[model samples]
Target: MLDLARERQGGVSDYRIAQLLGLKPNQISMYRHTAVKPSNPVAIRLAELCDLDPATVVAWVNIERATTPEDRLAWEIILKRLAPQKRLKQAA
Candidate 1:
């Protein structure tokens, strides 16, 4: 997610992204390092900053955070249904 943000539309620094997301720079760094997952609102805003679909991004994040098989499956289904066709094609 941060990768996308950094690579898109010229580019953005972690500090700039933090400012845009109303978070601290260390939080963005932690999220980039996989030491922490952004909360849903942060994830959505990050996706928006990256020119991504918030619903798809949130669904993907939920899948990664899911604890049970059923929970994961539900999020996967939602992601599959909500993600753009171009993104689905890229994944395939």
Candidate 2:
């Protein structure tokens, strides 16, 4: 999400992203560094900012945070279903 925002036209800083998300700059840094994951609402907001589907973003995050293999598999299936077929093939 941070990368997508930074790569946007004119770009956006971490501080600006934090403001946009109603979070602290350090919190944004934590997310950027993968030290923490954003909450569901925040994830949805990020998906909007990145012009991505909220379900796809949420499923991707759920996959990353899943503690059990079953949960991870479920999220993976959802993500695969949500993603384009061409991208799925390339991801393989």
Candidate 3:
């Protein structure tokens, strides 16, 4: 989510994102730095606000939540299953 926000056009500021999430700027900083876990609701809101796939974003959240290598590998496999295509086709 943080990477997506940074890669967005105009590059959304953490302060702006925090304001959008109704959270303190430092909280956003924590999330950015991985000092603490992010709330799923906030992550979903961020994904929606960024016009990203909520399911895909949630999959990423699940990956982040995994504490063990085996668990992370399972989530990675699930994500790969979910995204069998190399890329989404462009609209005509």
Candidate 4:
């Protein structure tokens, strides 16, 4: 999700994205880097603003919350959701 955001960010500053999400500029880096999980509202806004698939964005947050690092199951689930999103972005 962070990768997706970065890819789409263009000339938009992290501060601008933070404003869009109603968060601190520093917090944007944390969320973008996945150092912390963003709240549900932020996640929803992120999907809406970036035209991401809601399920895929939420699934990223879910994967971030996994108790285990290197969780293959979580990776598979995320990959499954992302495939269509990737295709759609490419088509656009």
Best by TM-score: 1
Encode model 3's per-residue lDDT on 1-92: one tens digit a residue. Answer: 67676556257788887887778999988886775767778878778777787666777887888899999898888778767542553322
lDDT of 4 by residue, 1-92 (tens): 54455457765777777887788898887865656888767888888777787767777776766667667477667769688878998899
What is the lDDT, from 0 to 100, of the residue 80 in candidate 3? 88
How many clashes show up per model?
Answer: 0, 0, 0, 0
The candidate that achieves the highest lDDT relative to the unseen native structure: 1
Off by over 4 Å in 4: 6-10, 68-92
RMSD, model 4, all Cα superposed? Answer: 4.4
Better of 2 and 4 by lDDT: 2
Question: TM-scores for all candidates?
Answer: 0.81, 0.80, 0.67, 0.60
List clashing residue pairs in candidate 3. none
CA deviation > 4 Å runs, candidate 1: 84-92
RMSD of each: 3.9, 4.4, 3.1, 4.4
lDDT of 3: 0.75
lDDT of 1 by residue, 1-92 (tens): 78788777358687888898999999987887774678899989989989887888898888888889999999998877775775766899
